[model samples]
Target: MEALLSQFSFLSSQALQDKNFDPTKIDDLMKFFELEAYNSWAAMETDLKKDVDEAEYTMKEAEDHLESVMDSAMDEFRRFEEELDRTLKDELDGLEQVANNAKKMGSSMENAATIATKKYMEAALVSATTTMKSAWKGLNFNSKKIHPS
Candidate 1:
């Protein structure tokens, strides 16, 4: 029994020394995601403001160019419509980029979790094996003394 206790203490201390659990990686990942999200949101907001400003400028130019001429007004209107279409396309592309970045972040987090779980399982298995080995040795010693052959 004393041998078993000493063996268990030694093995447990060794397992502690070889621990693989690291929490800093998780904190770093979260910080990265937070910064990425803020940057994306800021870019989208800037693009939206610029697009609105451009549309307003075009409208002002259209008003100044018109002088009771229907054909000229129609041409300016067409130009404004094309500019609006381009702005919408730009916004859509930005949204798509943001979605892709979010997906990448999620996958990175999942991979981190998987790695941590694997490390934990490996440590548990090592401890279990060590305990079994110690118990088997103790049992064998006692059995030999009892048999004396």
Candidate 2:
């Protein structure tokens, strides 16, 4: 029991540092951690149950041990839950940021395209107006021309 506790403690204490826990890696690590913790608790519970069945201790002692084991298991479970929650929150926040950035980029691109189209349209209008003015001038419309009514 002591050895099992020590092993669990050792594993729980092994924290990854200076590393990016991407989704895949984080998922894998969480799975392994969860498995180890669950196995440790299961082994402890099984052992205690066996002892109780074998009538190795007084009923009071068995109850106390069971309570102690439950408390320990709950503490471990809570720790794992909290860590998982934090990681999920972090990942969700990151995804939200990425979505926000994409939205901003799309808006920026739309603005740029609008501006470019406006400039091109203005240039085309000016060119057409100039060409029409020149064509009218070449016809000398201002010059007098006799016409039968």
Candidate 3:
């Protein structure tokens, strides 16, 4: 919808730019349209004055309407920009939070792995110590029996 309005604004400006008037031709045309007579000058003067008055009124009305349209367009544009800014900011915040959560998850996984490795190493050491003590006791008993006299 905003795109359509912007396109309309562009086309309207283009139309204003393309409206080239030939003042000489226009003046000749206006003169040709004037009536001829003694009171014609007075009548022409009155008619021209009326035309001028009408043109002025029309110009003022058009200017006022254009001003109103421009004000509305400005307000809409400001609102659109603010909305876009807010949307982008929200998306950015969501991404940041996701990144933070991933980091925390990675750290927690690493801590769990370290603890498991430490516990496994401790259990292996205790099993090896027990096996070595049993082997020594068996060796001593065998030596004493063979040496008995």
Off by over 4 Å in 2: 1-57, 142-149
lDDT of 2: 0.82
lDDT by residue for model 3 (12-86), tens:
566567777445544443454442333568888999999999999999999999999999999999999999999
Give the clashing residue pairs of candidate 1, or none: none
**TM-score of candidate 3 on Cα atoms, chains taken together:** 0.56
Candidate 2: how large is its RMSD?
33.2
Question: Which digits, one per residue and each the tens of the lDDT, describe model 1 over residues 29-85?
Answer: 557657767888999999999999999999888876664467787889999999999
Ranking by TM-score: 3, 2, 1
Q: List RMSD in Å for every model shown.
A: 55.9, 33.2, 22.2
lDDT of 2 by residue, 60-112 (tens): 78799999999999999999999999999999999999999999999999999
Query: How many clashing pairs in candidate 3?
Result: 0
Report every candidate's CA lDDT: 0.79, 0.82, 0.79
Off by over 4 Å in 3: 1-38, 131-149
